[model samples]
Target: MLNYIWSAIVLLSVVCSIFLGKGENLSAAIVDSGAQTVQLLLTLAGVITLWSGIMKIAEESGLTAIFAKIFSPLLRPLFPNLDKESDAFGSITMNITANLLGLGNTATPLGLKAMHELNELNGSSDTASDEMIVFVVMNTASLQLLPTMLGSLRQTYGSNAPFEILVPVWLSSACALSVALMIAVGLNKRKRRL
Candidate 1:
């Protein structure tokens, strides 16, 4: 469905360009778009590689473990279903830590592993459990102390103050996460009562 929508959009743009006698401009834009995409992919690859290497080093040196311990109190309530010493909890902690550092590309695999472990603990079923729903909600609204991706983009665009948006980002993310968690919890309770 999304593919079809994109195709339609491209077709409409071409038709509009032809009618406006701007076909050459459209062609130039298309070429520029492809070039920009390639550049973005290369940039993302470099960033992901650097962050993943750092994460691996941290894990091997027990830095991740120490951070996990530090953040355990906050994570405990969010994942009450998982045992404290379980691999699921560890993965979730690492994923959260990566997100907090704004290393989203590095966090993706950890998040998937955590979800897989969570599913296994839910009796290896195909269906998502209540805890899974809550986890998804929380992950979606996970807070970030650094906006790494945004900062990188800003730097690429020659921004004078890439980190200037930090405070607003923190405030917005906190409010959004709180509201999302509250709504998810409320709905879960309602479901249980019914």
Candidate 2:
């Protein structure tokens, strides 16, 4: 569906240029766009490679374990039923860390593992547990402390200050995560009362 939409957009642009008597200019733009695309991809590749390597180092050096320990107290309230020593706890910590860095690609596998662990804790129940719901909301909210992906995109597109949006991103993400948590908690309380 998206491929069709993109194709239509490209075709429309070319047709419109011809109708506007800008067909000759369109040829130059098309050539320029290809070069720009290559440059952008190269820039993005370097940034992604650096982040991936950093994540691997953090994992190997037990930095994530230390982080998990530090964040466990907060996790207790958010996931009351999760066993501290369980695989779910570890997977959840790693997933959150990945999200915090805005590394969605790295987060995906960790999120999947966390879901698997959550299912295990649910005692094979068909429905999701409260903790699982919270986890999903948190993932969706995605409160990024360091939005590397966005920064990289900005840099690729030739922004002068790529990471200047960090504060705004944090502010918005915090608000979103807070709202989601409130709604999830309210629903859970109402469910329990029923």
The global C-alpha lDDT for each of the candidates, from Candidate 1 onward, is: 0.85, 0.86
Q: Which ten residues in a row have the lowest lDDT in candidate 2?
A: 47-56
lDDT of 2 by residue, 1-194 (tens): 99999999999998999999999999999899999899887877786677768766877888777778977998898888887777788878888898899877667777888998899889879999999998999888978999988888887678999999999999999999999999997898889899
lDDT of 2: 0.86
For candidate 2, what is the TM-score? 0.77
Q: After superposition, how far is residue 113 of candidate 1 from its true place, in Å?
A: 0.8
Pull out the clashing pairs in model 1.
none
Choose the strongest candidate by lDDT. 2
Q: Which 10 consecutive residues of model 1 have the lowest summed lDDT?
A: 75-84
How much does each candidate deviate from the true structure in C-alpha RMSD? 1.4, 3.2
Estimated TM-score for each candidate? 0.93, 0.77
Residue 94, model 1, lDDT: 86
Residue-level lDDT of model 1, residues 45-142, one tens digit each, is 98889988988888788777787788889877766666877777777788888888877788898889889999999999988877788878877887
